[model samples]
Target chain A: MDWNKILLFSILVMVHVPIVSIGQEKLAMQWENVPEEIVQGRLEPQGTASFQRFPQELQKEVREPVWQLSRNSAGLYIDFESDASDIIVEYDVEDQFSFPHMPATGVSGLDLYAMDENSGWQWVRGIYSFKDTISYRYNGIKPAIKGSLRTFRLYLPLYNTVRSLRIGVAENSIFKPIKTKEQNPIVVYGTSIVQGACASRPGLAWTSILGRYIDKPVVNLGFSGNGKLEPEVIDFILRASPSIIVLDCMPNFRDSQKAEESIIKSIERIRAANDTVPILLIEHAGYSDGFVQNERLEIYENLNKATQRAFTYLKSQGINFLHLVKKEDINLGKESFVDGTHPNDHGMVGYAMAISKALTEKEILD
Target chain B: MDWNKILLFSILVMVHVPIVSIGQEKLAMQWENVPEEIVQGRLEPQGTASFQRFPQELQKEVREPVWQLSRNSAGLYIDFESDASDIIVEYDVEDQFSFPHMPATGVSGLDLYAMDENSGWQWVRGIYSFKDTISYRYNGIKPAIKGSLRTFRLYLPLYNTVRSLRIGVAENSIFKPIKTKEQNPIVVYGTSIVQGACASRPGLAWTSILGRYIDKPVVNLGFSGNGKLEPEVIDFILRASPSIIVLDCMPNFRDSQKAEESIIKSIERIRAANDTVPILLIEHAGYSDGFVQNERLEIYENLNKATQRAFTYLKSQGINFLHLVKKEDINLGKESFVDGTHPNDHGMVGYAMAISKALTEKEILD
Candidate 1:
């Protein structure tokens, strides 16, 4: 067709359907691309994919399982400000939709939270579809006050790798990316529970909860079934320049001797590199079956005993800023687990509460 | 020739494998069939399938969705007493293993709880597999006392239809089926939240939790999105001879006028037949995003207001044993929901607490 005919057709279409309002008086939607730099919780800004947890250099340094799990955007999130009443999120993931125990909402789905008038984070509900391309549509979002834009943080999938991501809002509404200021992040290096094994949603993960509570960035280096406190992972964690380092890998250890050695080495290596960064060593949040299973109870007791011994030895060597959290402190009740080993949302909240309380008691957050 | 060959093969197998001890010194396992009479929570014994919630006669009376959802073993469970240190459960399901938001553990999984020394039920953990034949193996179970057998209640799947079920224990351990005594049960009729949507496990559902709290059989008549206040379904609930009936289907209604009409009709019908049984009317548990979404908040408020009006009208009519539970009482904080509509494990607990508090306040459970 000629340019004149195309122009005439466009004019006819415009006349047929008004641009400002549709049949229901809804505003026309506009899509915006999100850049990689605005995404928080990664260890490095360079040498990694847009949503990957690890840098490209660590691909060969860490074990296969750790490297593979790092591809999941567990604790990574994007912060932005928007005035749109309706928010739409579209993303593509590279793996299966969900796990047996964990649902798609936690595995491959996105979770959204907006800042309230009091600066507290409130969860935003979205209607999601997980077909070939995942999409989340949040309707009727209101600002904290009239004529004001609201700040929102969108958490990525907890157990799936994303291929692409984009956000859509009503046309003519303001959409601004919020850059995270340069600050030391709280680094958590742990196991499947830390990586959000059985949480119903991404934002319910313990690390994400802690970040919301403290209003700071928390880097999640949690490798499912592979958080062994290896020297390679610790070296990379040190590079993040973390203010508080948490090592919670006792659940991954079956042998007490190996666990003690790894704990001492991980702490000593961190101390050697940085003198005063607070290091918190967390004992295994014992299996929920520990109440009825003597063998599981024995394993938990032995591992916790090893962690206690490691803490005592490290403190004896004049290691400062070292703290330990016992298994009892986690206090995951019998009802908290989805499986006996992994925590559901209730357990996730419990974990965040205990960790935050310990941080407060140690004056680490101060 | 067949008898001789069979005898020779059995002798050889016995010689190769010891009867009393295995490689790990575990006891010889024995399987026991769970009789239909022993399973609790179904409305009637002879009319329904072993694990079905509704009787066969109601198939023609209820809507198609309601009838189909009735096939799901949402609230059915088995009560038994055993002395074995380990327990195994094997069952088969009829439909897909899970949903997009709810996992297989809450759909087709089995949850076991045993009465402790203080008579409080404690969760028992199990390793589960959801293959063609779903199975759960709970190892190293310890009784409350050294020499006494423990009473265990195993919750069935909350969202899938069970085809068959069986329990396995050590060869010499005593396995006794605990028959549910004839008594008035607490009948709950509601929507997906009551049917255990997005729950991490079966035992975490609100009705199951309430049953444990009250130490009585609680019949769950939740029908997912089809939980409209229909007379056909209400008739089945009345047949259970409920000690207290809970109506929590406000979330399933969108129109306030229609909801008010249905509420008034339902209560009047129940009052027509029975007058002494307590009827608790629950307001809508507001959406988690209601704080930010004015549209959702409006819907919740309108529905709740309609419920309040219905309650006042019914009470003015001199309806006896009537109670109302306000939305403020449920108080599902912003973090309680998985998706905004359905309550997660934390929200489920909140729901149970509110309903049980109302029941206690009204002296219905007394």
Candidate 2:
């Protein structure tokens, strides 16, 4: 090698050393910033995490803590004490399990759940009072409670010594506060699954997951097994004046007749409320039960046919507010579900991914 | 009123009345020719409307009549009466309870709830066995002894009489029938939500829903809660030779650092395996909580920023793919969720609709 060539190689090495070192340094910094709990990729032990504990006075009467809960006119009061500069109250409420005939029964109350480092988990009804120290109330329940649990994971920033806390009822404590103003609300209306039954946590639920991802407010109008494309529900949803309306009711219908008529009627009803507001229609996921035996497969075929017909008709009628997700992409097979019906945590992740994929590919979220 | 005009109109009416009545009669006759169920907007129930009771030997262990059971493999021997036709076996492996995590625990298999004109609501499990007669099993344990109830609602076709039923384990009886060779199959891999949860029925999941719409066989590889954008998972997914790979993990990451880095790495890893497979990336839905206070709104902002950066980077690298759903269109807000998180039925519907809209707009789905 020539002397000049050696000099050039040395310069190149000298310049590349800092760049490589910078990359290593950045990686080290990231590792340092990552929380140890998540870094280990295991469920972290619930430690001294600040949480609202139910007061002894009302503890016995409350039900299990759910991921989401709501109640009609009746206020849900939660009480808690924190020295944090900022705190957030979170909860999950909706009907995912119930009788089909009782369409709106699950909308009348709130679901509440709490977890702290000290206590593993606690379930509570919607009301809590703390000796006039603090209270919080949530009003707006027209549906009955469904699903097993609704969780409330409030984020609080501490500034001083914090002891016990209460959730479920209302609270008026002097904690660091962060003010939030509501903005364009997204509204969704559909079938029972949308009500959220088998979800492990409110955050894991696709709707909740979406909310957390977008960092926006959302109002859920998912009736449990009774999402039958009723005009009454549509009217109520319209009155709420949501920026968008999502219609997914084909799953509840036993066959094509109900799916076809209800889907068309739903489109018309929603269009009457807001002509330009976007309306999305989602098809049911295809089941494999029929695939095993050729006989039951027609059900899915008919559903697809009906959905396509409805979409075509809607598009021809100049109803530009529509979208859809097919069944095959949604079902991951038997292993995807804990049972043959509801999905597991892994299933939910798949669902979110599919929806997200569809959205991105179509450029609806841009 | 003109007298002459009235008289002429009456004369014309008198002339047309008989003809109009005759036409009406013909229309009525045509209507009568149509099936009553069709006229009533319900499809006529088809196939044999009876199920063979399990043999006495099988009944020795069954507590209830198995309504609709399936065994995928041939390990458990089933013997049936020679003349028994249209027999359907239904079993409930576990007692029905409104318990939390029941769906996730796999205790509850597929349940078929049917209504009849005489009796109201009836339910049947999807798995059972036949011995000397027909018997049902609840859980892995057989009933302490055997006695069977008659299933009223579920009907089995006589042509499929003497069908073997399969229940527990991955393979065996009725549910997983023999599969025929296929030349093409679609594979989908994504986050946990895609795995399917909270859907009322197996057919309602978006993945399954999509499959039905497209008229294709799909393999689902959705893992719940475990949908971190890991290179290992991506590599595993690529090995399946899927028709398409959808990336939807932004919501799972708490911050942009993980999302951006992992997304890029995942894409690169996937590309390394299959250079030309269609890759679709999905952004997160708007957060319902953000709609309230707009806290963490920057999460999406950062995600989008990173997405755009990645898109440009990929484009420069000669990679071709699509992005689905936009933040503005699919933001999670009050109207979209029942609680601060988790989409009610309405939210799921909305999500499906958005995905469909994005696909249609982008011409990715016909």
lDDT of each: 0.85, 0.39
The candidates' DockQ values read: 0.59, 0.02
The TM-score each candidate achieves on chain A is: 0.92, 0.54
Error of 1 at B347 (Å): 0.9
lDDT of 1 by residue, B1-366 (tens): 453344234222211112433336655677776666777988786667777888778889999999999989898888899999877777778899888888889877889998887648888888788899898887778876887889898999999987767677877788898998788898999998899886888998999999987888898889899889999988888877888889989989999999999999999999888878889898998988888877888998999999999999988999979888998899888668899888888888888888888888878886
Q: Which runs in model 1 stand beyond 4 Å of their true positions?
A: A1-28, B1-28
lDDT tens readout by residue for model 1, A136-171: 988788876888989999999999998777787877
Residue-level lDDT of model 2, residues A1-366, one tens digit each, is: 253344233222211111112212321110001111111100111220111111222223333321111111111122232322122222222223222111111222223323333432232222212122322233221111232222233321100111222222112222221222234455556444454433433444455444444544444444445567776556656755666566666666668977888889888888877887666677776543343223345676787789888888888988875777777656554333433344444455566667656655655552
lDDT of 1: 0.85
Q: Candidate 2 residues B1-366, lDDT tens each?
A: 253344233222211111112212311111001111111000111111111222223223322312122111000112111111122333222223112211212212222222222433222234333223333322221111132222221222111122222222111111211121232334444443344333333333344444434544443334444456655446545655666666666655667766777777778887877877766677766454442223445676687777667766777777765454566655433434333433433444455556556655665542
RMSD score of candidate 1 (Å): 7.3
DockQ of 2: 0.02
For lDDT, the strongest prediction is 1
